[model samples]
Target: MRIELQNTFVELRGEQNPVASAVLDALRSNGATVGAVAPVPDILIVSLPLLPVAGYDPATQLQSAMATGEAMFARGSGRVLFLVSAAAGMPMRRHAEFSVAMAGVLATVRTMAMQLGPKVLVNALGVGAIGEKVVAGDAAMLGHASVKRPGTVAEVADTALFFCDPLNSYTTGQMLSVDGGWSAGYGRNF
Candidate 1:
């Protein structure tokens, strides 16, 4: 079940993101071309911030992602993969904004899949504590997760490859959680 994106054209939207870099590398390795956004790219990869940024706005970000998807779907056949955080499911009283954004990303993925089906495939990869504890939620959630460690950025990139694979014909409107079993039992200790 290896990912094969040969000759696929990918348009990546992320600002100095290492995960995006990793994804691009993997895609290029698999014979994909990373370039500017075309009218309709073979694959549209949006790398949403895994941790809360200084001025992150959930509504605005989600709106932009949807707009991007709509524009990319103009030609009918394409794949949209949003790289978001799985920790969004683990609500921390201190990070309402981020939680909302993450939840919105998931919902948007589903809704878009429904609206743009039969040709365009929409999916997401929910990232989880990929590095040192950056926020209060990460520390709290990791305690309950069976895998008491953070995931690697490469893991997220690999999942992106999976979602972008043209062979994955049956799966759409789904978020494959790469958070190391955290979602399976995230709030167990809480």
Candidate 2:
């Protein structure tokens, strides 16, 4: 099966990006043939890395995300897993653009799930931090998480792979927060 990954530059560029490595490893383990989103039956994996610290553009990012979603929905089989940051729902300092853009992505996932359901299973896996390397250029909110530490790449990849599983026939339009309780509430120790 072909897997079309939207954002893979960080994964491809960083030696310290364990999430990327784990994603690739998971795909390999599952024997998935990964490729671009052409007019082919491929599993679409949308990964949103840390947005650029400077020059963040919400409109452009949103459009790109929508276009990609439309393309995948039109061309590939009805399966999309958004492996993104918790920023989609939880905002952080100086990350307004990222937050907005991710919200758009989540909206697309939900709308597509509703429109294409029974035929497509669209879901999101929200991650906080994979490693310092992964969030080097972006503002990280893992300190507020109950775990108070970066999540392992394996944790995230496994979730992504689960959503991509061919037998996952019943889920759609859901956001799975895999952020170590970051989205649960404020982490406090008394």
List ranges where model 1 is wrong by over 4 Å: 132-139, 186-190
Alpha carbon deviation, residue 106, candidate 1 (Å)? 1.4
Q: Model 2: per-residue lDDT, tens digit, 58-99?
A: 455445445555655665445666666676766655676677
Per-prediction TM-score to the true structure, in the order listed:
0.85, 0.73
* Candidate 2 vs. true structure, TM-score: 0.73
> By summed lDDT, which 10 consecutive residues of candidate 1 come out lowest?
131-140
lDDT of each: 0.73, 0.61
